[model samples]
Target: MATGLDANGAELFTLELARFNGQVVLRSVLRDANGLAERSAWFAIDPAQTAIEFAWQAAGTDAANGYLRLAVGSAFQVSGDRREPARLSGLRVLQQQGVAWVSLIGTGN
Candidate 1:
């Protein structure tokens, strides 16, 4: 799991990897101050690819208002509605060994 933060170091969202139906997927969750999920989405991660792109919206929303592109060894690229912009970018690999890693978002140059 990885916690994404804003420029001021406030928690904005969490990205986690989990197995569902025997397949690994990435889960992105945006939580409110009380830790309630505000919006969330799941994206399939392909180990053969260097990047993954996804879009999401709130439960009652008419359209997707959030988009994110994450690439290994590169900064995160995000774009979408102004009110729901992903304030975090970049990834810092704090620790890594083989396929496992500990990382932080928005902490890299």
Candidate 2:
């Protein structure tokens, strides 16, 4: 799980990776006054390239959308069609036993 913060360093959301059906997906939960609001769909992970690709429609809008092409390594890099509402600050990948865990920090815009 990852916690995302706003530009001023306030917690904005938490993100997780999970299995949905037979595919892996990214889940996001916004932290608001009413508590957490969760949103999840589909995303593609390319092990060969150590990258994740996803596109999500902006809330209450059909025209505005956000996309990400995140590369994972000792440090993370955003490339390709990357256009996110948040600014990434830090990322780290860790492995224990056979599971991989990703920690991300970002500034929500």
Candidate 3:
């Protein structure tokens, strides 16, 4: 299981694994200490990289849409492509997000 916090440091959501239709499923909902809001579709979980990637898409639609999002920690590294690996220090976004005290937790190693 994992937890997300908003800009105000409020509990934003919780991501967990559950049994759905006799299969293990991962899901996320916008319900924390505040209250219940909406549920975001859980896409993929990369345990090896300690990352959970998701997308907000319409049902019955299998298209490349929404954000290519990721939440990871120190041991995890973001890349540009399959062949070329990207260095976080080389990216302006990471510099803006700040890597001072990051906590990355997931089911993966």
Candidate 4:
């Protein structure tokens, strides 16, 4: 079970990612119940701009978890994988109080 929370509320998403082989760039959208735009951002692992925060779960040698990519924005599943560019999923916005908080989800298929 994966856990996540933004300025909004708590939510669940794919956090544990496995090593892959080739590039798995995403080119479609499956489900984005929570819009993640204007909130979160994608970053590289191992290292990147301190300003950009990469989840420890997204660390390692996996390409998908390597370099920082793009903000998940309104689009959830776009194009991103471990080995080869695959499909990136699990992105949404957790609402709380009277504000739509930021989104921080994983990309797992």
List candidate 3 segments past 4 Å from native.
31-34, 40-51, 54-109
Separately for all candidates shown, the number of backbone clashes (residues 3 or more apart, or on different chains) is 0, 0, 0, 19
Candidate 2, residues 28-68, lDDT tens digits: the string is: 55544345554544344443455442222222233224343
Give me the runs in candidate 2 sitting further than 4 Å from their true place.
6-10, 53-100, 103-109
Q: Can you give the lDDT of residue 24 in candidate 2?
A: 58
Q: Report lDDT per candidate.
A: 0.48, 0.43, 0.36, 0.29
lDDT tens readout by residue for model 4, 1-109: 1233323442322222222343222221211234432223332222122221223133244454522233223323223332322222334444568564433333332
Model 1: per-residue Cα lDDT at residue 86: 39
Across 1-109, the per-residue lDDT of candidate 3 in tens digits comes to 5455444445444455556555544555544234655465543334555544532221123332322124433322121112111111111111225552223432221
Q: TM-scores across all candidates?
A: 0.47, 0.40, 0.34, 0.20
The Cα RMSD in angstroms, rounded to one decimal, for candidate 3 relative to the true structure is 13.2
Query: Top lDDT: which candidate number?
Result: 1
* Model 4, TM vs. native: 0.20
Task: List the candidates ranked by lDDT, beginning with the highest.
Answer: 1, 2, 3, 4
Clashing pairs in 3: none
Measured over all alpha carbons after superposition, the RMSD of each candidate to the real structure, in angstroms, is 7.4, 8.4, 13.2, 15.4
Candidate 1 per-residue lDDT, tens place, 1-109, comes to: 5566666565556566677897666666665545576444555565345544333322224444545344433424343342443355433332445543542222332
